[model samples]
Target: MTNTAQPPQQPEIPDVLSEKKLRYVDIGINLGDPIFRGVYHEKQAHDDDFHDVVQRAVEAGCEKMMVTGSDLKESEHAVQIAVENPGLCYATVGVHPCSAKQFDTHAGGPAALLSALEDLAIRAKASGHAVAFGEIGLDYDRLFLTPKEPQLKYFEAQLDLAVKVQLPLFLHSRAASEDFERLLGARLPELPKRGLVHSFTGTIEEMQRLVALGLDIGVNGCSMKSEDNLAVVKEIPLERLQIETDGPWCEIRPSHASAKFLAGAPPMPKAVKKEKWAKGLMVKGRNEPATIPLVAHVIAKVKGVPVEEVAEAAYNNSIRMFGLGSMENASS
Candidate 1:
């Protein structure tokens, strides 16, 4: 009988580094969203546009990114993208609170929906590219999309699933702090230690509670919307903070008008540069992973830390939380 033994596989090559260049990790980006389609020079191929976005992000010093998965279909696509890109990208697998209706009994029932999500999570984990389980949590602001009861039900289920899978979380919360806090607080001991409250727009008191719970806070354009939000941002400890784009959605508020904020803004990548972008289909201020530096810049100014310091801290936090092994080798 012939032996069919195969040799051990070598790890993928890490991003080439320049000693002077700072590396950043966007802990969240919805790259699979259709909003990005045709935004890059009216490109017809989504794969090409996606690659362009990744390349530009790398060039802009965003060395790594976590593609968010709001539902099972998006989660599958996210994992595939992460697998295809290897070192540059990772994925989160979960259902968003707004889409809680999909898991409702009236729709397809929680058992079927959750079973599908669990399978996707297992497959994603096996791929060596999935980092967390989320875009999951409560979103009372969009209760019209899904009522409160089902949203709570699904959030609890996903939390339990995260514990089962032993992965970190990429969480969301908006205008639903009471129930969000209560549900999450009940499961605090059961959930993974390294979870993020992505795109946090909560009050300082709420932020403090989450921090006390040992969860990291994700700051994006929405988090910097007003003086009230800026005040909340200022109160967040540097050690507990991470930055994200939440792209094709949250761009830095134009109303900020601070020279420091404007100065820190990253320029548009040449890959996506075009005189005219697709109307209506594309957002007026389309955020992308390449703009992570800009988010970092805003964070630095708000935190009163150097931009490089903010970048390094966020990068370090992301790698530590997500267990991104490739970056450990690259950083060393």
Candidate 2:
């Protein structure tokens, strides 16, 4: 007698597992930050040092990225990088609150600084490489960087510039929520509807207030610091959330670590070995845009949603908030 048995059926794939690899858009990255320079090994004379980082990011599924502009010079550099890379990158043009003092010290003082920023915004926008106006807002946490008064003054000036340029705002706020809320709230009616609070580490109440005002929330390592923070993350509405690496800083929080998140992350290029990282830190100490998927993974775990869902919502939300046209256009 001959007997035959069918092979045991394979387990069905979960919808999340069946989906394609999650493509991402980093809504914020300081690609021009000095820390990024020489992070990779020295290359040949003809090599484009920065382009290597961009290539690695794309390979890791971050198809598009918005290089943050924290000041006038950095904003110019960010725009230049974006222009050089075209569809793969874009920029925000504004002075950070920390750099607010530049306004007073600039050649013709605050008026000249404001005029120059306006000129940059106008030029950056015309290049089809500028997506917003910021990295701007109040940051009392780093008061040493800029006194509260200057922070507020320049923040207000940049808000006015954002209004004039009609670009979405890439806002920053820390430890000065009361003042931040008051100032931004007063101007809410005049600001564009598409702005976001980047690196948001605020309370649920604060997050709610921002969402209520039609602003999206940008999450990164800094935003996931504690159980309380993760709890707040769970409360954020999917459509109102976006993920960023905020690289060279804000790697995923230690408490929220998971190998699963890093599974999709791109490996450090051979040119940059683990031993080369800055002292007293792991290889991840220098965060890169490629780690964005890890950010999505942490969000998925905290919110009890599929990673794919987090990735899709974030990718789409970024495109919508930044008016990145279409994924095809933005990622081309």
Candidate 3:
């Protein structure tokens, strides 16, 4: 038989880019990832074009972005990125559940590791480089990366850090809702500003429960992968909703359920395969903060609201949640 298999189709990019500049705040991005620095799998594939990436995002109306620190080293790097960029970028410092093992394995032991994280958060918060405390929480779906016990233990421990610093949280949870909810509930009273459960791909009930507990939900491409996800997103209260790119990762692809909504939204620039990367172009498989508008477009479509309504609501909710200050002040 002749080979009947077909290569995957590339997502169609609209010919015209959106001219309506709507401001956005990408709540979660892993900027410390080597991909942003033009490194791929431990080797350099292209020149470091991090500034180019930032500039493209600004043109896309993502005026501010929060860089996620998945562990100690990345957390430090995230603060550095925020410091260097000033108001343009902020950092979230914490050990993701996947890296929970780092606590016990640290040279100075778990207490010392926690102490170091506390110190980083304190200084960064004072300097306004760190706006939230996290990228931390449970991820049972990938338990192979970490066990449940330490995830639970240190998730609570970090909650304590959040209380100490009095900063809002940038949280995560996947296939671990029971313990995630339980732990967060126990600490909710202590965290006045609450936090956001980002990249939420949970059931409507889970979303409702978290909202009831006074938390906000963050959506990205990965959060809208299927019809069920769209249904859940539609029900999220406008005031309780926020947006993020979770970038260098969750770009809105043509294959996602959100793609159909991209019909009339802003068009992304040309994308080249990583090996053939150039300035002013996006890497084919790498997501960037610039595509944040597509995320807003999808949410607006699913919720039957205008794209502006979604963008503005998400922007205000993020500014309020992360204490980014009034819109006028922020834009200034």
Tell me, by TM-score, which candidate is best.
3
Candidate 3 per-residue lDDT, tens place, 230-286, comes to 999999999999999898888777788878878887778999998888777889989
Off by over 4 Å in 1: 1-20, 39-48, 105-108, 257-260, 264-266, 270-284, 327-332
Candidate 1 lDDT, 1-332, residue by residue in tens = 11112212432212332224578888889878765554344444332244445655676788788999999889988887787677778899999999888886534678888888888888777666788999899998998999998898889999888888877888999899888888888776876565999999999999999999889999988888888888888888888889988987787766753224657355553323333432211234667776677778877787788888888888888877786656463331
Candidate 2: tens digits of C-alpha lDDT, residues 1-332: 11112212342222322234579999999888655554344532222234445655665678789999998889888888787777878999999988898888888988988888899999878767888999899988888889999998888878878888888899998988888888888776876555999999899999999899889999998888777888799999999999999986888644553333445443333333444533212244667786787788888887888888999999988887786647554532
> Which residue pairs of candidate 3 clash?
none
Question: Which is superior by lDDT, 2 or 3?
Answer: 3
TM-score of 2: 0.84
List where candidate 3 sits over 4 angstroms from the true fold.
1-18, 325-332
TM-scores, all candidates, are 0.84, 0.84, 0.92
Model 2: number of clashes? 0
On the 0 to 100 scale, the lDDT of residue 224 in model 2 is 85
Superior by lDDT: candidate 1 or candidate 2: 2
Candidate order, TM-score descending: 3, 1, 2
